[model samples]
Target: MNRRGFMKLMGSGAGLAAGSAIMGSTLVQNAMAAAPRRGGTIKLAWVDAVDTLDPHFTASLGSVKILNNIFNGLLKVAYDGKKVSFVPDLAETWEMPDDKTHVFTLRRGVKFHNGDPCDAAAVKWSLDRVKDPAVSSPHAWKFETLAGIDIVDESTIRMRFSKPYAFLPVALTGSTGRAGTIVSKRAVEQHGKAFGRNPVGTGPFKFAGWRENESITLERNPDYFEPGLPYLDGVKILLIKEPTAAVAAMMSGQVYGMSLSPFQFIPQLKANKNLKVYGEVEGNYSFVGMNNRRAPFDDPMMRKAVAAAIDRNTIVKQGYFGEAIPAYSCISPPMTGFYDKNIGNSGRGQRFDLKKAMEYRKQSKYQGEVNPVYIVAQGFTGSGGSGTRNSQLLLPMLEKIGIKPKIELLDRAVWTKRRNGGDFDMYDEAWIADLDPDETIYPEWHSGKPWNFVGYSNKEFDKLLSEAQDTLNQATRKKLYD
Candidate 1:
C-alpha cells in the first residue's frame, strides 16, 4: 500500500479495529481491507540459493534481499525505483568536497538488534573488518579497492580513495556485491564463526533462526527505528532452488512471492486474478563463457569466429523467452555508462556472419579437430524437469559453420568442483550487474586480476578502465570508457 493511503486508514480507530478482525484472512483480501494487518509469515522463494548468512561474504540476489531486513548500510538507495540515488540510512548525511574523499555523519539513537549502540566506532570496525585479507568477503572488494577509511568521531567517518572512484556511494546499499552492509563489532567478536547464524544489525527485522538449506526465518525488531513499519511479524525464506517448483508454490499460496519463472509462465501468471506480477528490466547477461586458457578459444581468431557466427537474436527468440535481449558484448543494458558503442547493441559484435566466422577460423594456426565443451549442472532434480536442454538444435547451426561443441552435463556436486577447478572449455554462466559500471566490467576483463575467468586481457583495455575510474567528469569518463 502507498504511504499516504496507509496513513489515512491508520488514522481512524474504526479502520484499525476492522483490520484486527481480518487477521486470519487471505493476503489479497487483507490488502484490499482498509487497515494494515500486524502479523503473518511472508514466505518467499528465490531463483538463486543462498549458501552463507554472513552479510559480507556473498554476492547473490537471494541472500542480499533477505539480508535487507536484517542489516542497514551507512547509506541506501531510496526505494522509489528511480535512478539509484543515495539517501540516509545509518548515516544521517554525508559530504564529499573532492572526488577522492568522503565524510559521513552517522545517525544517533540507533541500536543493533542485540542492543549495542551503533556509533562511528562500530561503522569503522565493520568497514575495517571487511578489508582483512583473510576475510576476503565477496562484498569486501568495495573497501579493499579504496585507499582507506578514517574514523572521525563516535558519529562520523571519513573515507579516502587511492584513486578517483565515482561509484563509492552506490556501493553502500547493502551487503552483496558492491553493497556494503554494516555489522556490529561486538557481535562478531563474541560469536566468531557462529555470527552468520546470529547476526546483529540496526534493520527492521532481527535474526530468528536458519534451518540450513531448508528455510531461514526472521522476527521483527521491536525497537525498529521506523515506527509502524515492516508491517509483518516475520519473513521466512525457503531455499527452493528449483524455479518451476517455486512458481508452483507461489500459485498455491504456499509462498507469498518468488523471483521470475520461465518466460512462458509470465502470461499464465498474469492471467491469474488473485496474483500480482511485478517486473523491471534487469542488468543480467547469460552467455557461453569460453575458457580462454584452453586450446580453440585460446586462439583469439577462433574466439572471434565463434563470436561472429553465433546468431544472438535467434538465440533470444528461440532459446529464451522473447523477454531476453540479444547480447554480443559483455555489459548488460541496465548499466548506463559502460556499454562500448563500437560493440553491437546486444553487447556482442554483430549478428551471425558465417563467411567471416569461417575466414577467421581458417586464418588461425590450429588445423586439428576442434572440439568445444559446453558444461551444465544436473542438480535441479526434484520438482523441476531435467536440468539440461536439448543441444541437438545447436549442432546443426554449428555444423554449418564447421564448429562442434561436445555437450557435457555434470551433477551439481561435481559441477561445483569442476567449475572452481577450471575443468571445461565453455560453461553457461550468468552475471547480475552491480549498481555501478566499473563493478560490472573490472572483475571480468582485467588481466591477472582474479575473477577474470576467461583468461582474456589486453593492456589497452586495462588502461582505459583505469582512466575511466579516475575521470570525475561524466562525459570525460564516458569518453575514456569508450
Candidate 2:
C-alpha cells in the first residue's frame, strides 16, 4: 500500500505471520526444550474484515496477517537471537551477479494447494501477473524497474532489471511478502476474479473455508515442503470486528490469539498471566496526511499551522495508551541506519502550539473560511476505531485554532478508494512492515504516485528519491533521503 502512513503496530518479526499467528508458534518454540508437539487447532481473533485473498492485490493488514499462513514467498525474515536477516522461503538460494541481475534457484517438489507445480514457469507467470496492466495490482510499483525475466532451466530463473533496485530483496517479504509470494497460474485462470477468495499458494496451510463476516479456516497441508511445520492441524480465524468484543474473546479464552489489538486494551491484555504479548519492534508507523494539491493545505504555511496544532505527545499518550513512541518523522526509529534519531530534537518536530499555528494561518494566502474536511476509515483491525477516535480528538484541536472540521467516516474499501483518488482534504493514512526508507518515502510522497493521496509534488524530492533507490551504499542513501 506504499506509505499507508504509519500506525503503531503491536509487533514486528523479521517476517511475521499475522500478529497473533506468529505468536501462536511460540507455544511450540517454548516446548522445544523437550520436543515441540504438533497437532492442534489454534483459534485466532482478527479485528479487521478481509475481502481480498490474493496477496498481490490486497493491502489490508488483517488479510496479510492471515494470508501469511496460507502463502509462501521467495524470501522471508529470520532472526538468529541477535539480528534479523533475509532467509529463503520458496527459493532455496539466490545469486546476485550484478546490481541489476538476480539468479534464483527454486526448491523442487513445492506444490500449490491446487496440485499445480510451483516451478520456474509458475514463478515467471506470477511475477508477470503482478506487473500486468490488466491486474491493476496496488503492488505493481514494486516491480516498476524490472526489465525482464528469463527461465534458465526448470528450477532456475534470471531476473534482470533496468536499474539498481535496493527494495527488491525485501520487497518479496514486504509486510506479508506479497509481491514475491508466488501464486498458482492455473488456479488464477480457472477462478479468474474469484481467485482472491479461493487463492492457491505453496504455503504450509491451505485455505479451507470462509464465511461472510464470520470466520476463515485453514487446514494444514499434508504434503507441506517444510517438514512437520504448521504444527497446528488447522487454524480457525474468527472475524471479531469490534475492539470490545475482540478483547472479551481474548480474556474469555474464546480464541487462542488476536491480531491488530487496540492500544487502550494493551494494559489489561498484558496484565493477564495466562496470555503472552508479542511486542517486537518493527518499522511500522501511523500518520495523518493532507491533500497537498487541495485547498488550505496547498499552502505550506497552512500545513505547518495544522502540524503545530496537533500535539504528537498527547496523541501517543491518549491514543496509543502510552504503548507507543511519538513519531517525529515518517521513517521510524527501528530502521536505524537511515532514521534521523535527532530529528525530534533538531529544533523541528511535531509541535503543539495554538499561538504558532494561528500565526502560520495568518500568514497563509487562504483568507477564506477554513474547511477542515476530515476523512477517516475503518482500517486496522481492533484499531478500526482508530481513525474515528482520532477524528474526534483532532476536530476539536482544529476548531480551537479557528477551523471548522467534520468527520466523514467511510468503510475501508470506500475510504481507500476516495483517498487514493485524491478526493479528500485531510485523512488518516498508515504504512506497515516498511523494510526500507525508500519504501516509506518514494511511493507515497513522490508526485502523483499511487498512495500519494496527498498529491504532493516536488522535483527535488523525486530526484533525491530516484538517486536513493539506485545509490547502493547506505551512507549515501541516507544522505539523499536527508
Candidate 3:
C-alpha cells in the first residue's frame, strides 16, 4: 500500500508530515526490516528494549523474554479467533470457592530451563519474590489482592487472596502477577544477573541466545511436555525501532507478525490484503494527563473543564482509524465487571464544546491562553526523540474546544523521565492491556501512587476502591465502585 492510502485508512495526516510524505523511503525501510528467510528463523521487533532477565526482578521489556519461553504458568488461556480457552501448560486443574482464591493441582515432572524441578516449594518462593520491595515491579498493582500462597503439598498449590477478583484467571496471563507460574528457587540464588540470559521453562521453546538491542533467539524444546508442538523449530526477535519499517516487513511477508502501536500503522495494515492483522480492543485507555501539581491543572474546575471539553469520538475516528474507543473513566466499559457505568460520564466523544470549556476556564480564574503544554514522542512511533506532528493534531482539536495547547516536544528518554516525574501540563499516554478496573484505577488514580502521573489525589476514589476490594457481593462491589 502507498503512504497516502495508509494514512487515509488510519485518518488524516497532520503538520510537516502531511506536506512532505516520503512513501518510497518508508517502503524501502519497511522492506529492509522485514527481509529475511523463514525456516527456523522468525524476525520480530520488540517495541522497547528488554529491561531485566529475571522474571521476579523483571522491571522492563526483558519480561517479554521470560514470557514466551522461560516461564510456564499453571494454566494457559489461549485467545484464538476472539475466543478464550483454558489449556494445560503448567497447572493441570484448579478450583475456586466464592471466586476469592484458587486451589491448583500443580503439574508433575516439570523442570525449569536450568534443570531445577518446579515444585510447591519453588512456587511459594516465586510468589514471595514478586512481593519483595526490592523488585519494585512496574506491575506491583497486580499483587495487591495476593494475601499469600499456601503450598498444600508437593503437587498442590493454593493461592488465597485478600478478596474476590473476577479477573484473577486473566490476570495470571499478564506480564506481571504471581499466578501458577512456578520459578525455581534454586535458579534465582544460583544465577541472579546471568539467569535472565540463561533461563529455563517448561514451555515448548528454550533459550537460544540474546544479542542486546539486536535479537533474541530461541529453539523448540525437545523434551517439552507437549511433544511435536511449537510448530516452528526456532524464532528470532529483531529489535527494530521504527513502526513504518515493521509494517513494511509485515507487508513483504518478511515476518509473520509484529507488535505495533495501532495509531501509527493501522492504515498500512488495512491496505495490505495478503497480510493478516490481528488486533484486540484492549482494556487499556489513554487520556490527556495534566500535571495537577503544575499551574492551572492544579485547579479541579480546570481539570473538569478539560475533561468535558474533549471530543473523544472525533479523535478516536480520525486518529485511530475507528480502531479505538473514546474513554471517560480510568477503565473502559467493556472491562467494567461489577463497577457502575454511571459513576462517571465516560461517554464523552469527539464534539468540540468551546463555550463549555471556556465557561469552566473562566470558573478556574486562569490567566491568558491557559496554553497547556503537551509532550509526545517526536518520531512516528517515537524513539527517544522530539517533534510537533503529534501535538499539531491534538492542539487544534483542543483549541476548538476553548483550550490552547502549547506543544513541548521532547526526546523519548527525556519525555519518559518527565512524565514519570510528573512535570508537564498535559501528555499523551496509555496503558497496554489491563483487563481489570482495579488494574486501571488503583495505581493510576489513587493518591500517592507512583503511576499517578498527573498527581491527581482523591481520597473518595481510594475509599471506593477499598470497599470494592473486600465486598463479596458482585453487585455491592460494583455499587461501591460506582
Per candidate, the number of residue pairs that clash is: 5, 9, 17
Error of 2 at 171 (Å): 1.5
Candidate 3 Cα outliers beyond 4 Å, as residue runs = 1-39, 47-50, 53-69, 78-89, 96-101, 161-167, 174-181, 191-199, 261-273, 333-352, 380-390, 400-403
User: Candidates ranked by TM-score, best first?
Assistant: 2, 1, 3
Instruction: Please give, for residues 268-328, the per-residue lDDT of candidate 1 as tens digits.
Output: 6677776777654465555455677877677676666665666655555555545555554
RMSD of each: 12.0, 6.1, 8.8
- Candidate 2: Cα lDDT at 232: 80
For residue 147, model 2's alpha carbon misses the true position, in angstroms, by: 0.7
TM-score of each: 0.84, 0.88, 0.78
Q: Order of all candidates by lDDT, from best down to worst?
A: 2, 1, 3
Top candidate by TM-score: 2
lDDT of each: 0.63, 0.70, 0.57
TM-score of model 2 relative to the true fold?
Answer: 0.88
What overall lDDT, based on C-alpha atoms, would model 3 receive against the true structure?
Answer: 0.57
lDDT of 2 by residue, 1-482 (tens): 12211211101100100111000011100112356668988888877667689898876667887778888878887756544467778898989999899998999989999898999999999999888889988778889899999999999989999998877876777236477878899989999999888988888889998888899899999878997687889999898878789788888888878776776777788778777776644545566677777676777777767776776666666666655655655666545666665666764335467798788778888875687677888554423245566667677777766777666888877887888787888777556645577666676776666667677776755666777788777776665555
User: Residue by residue across 1-482, what tens digits does model 3's lDDT show?
Assistant: 22122112112110001111101001112223355443465566555446555554443432554465657766655656443445555777788865678888877887776677777777777767666678565555666678888889998888888777655664465243323355667766777767667665567778788887677788877667765566667878776666566666777777766655435565666566675555555444455667878677777667656655656655555555465555544435445353234533543221245576667677776745667777775552421111243355566655654568777767767888888887778787645344455655666666776577877765555666665555656566454544
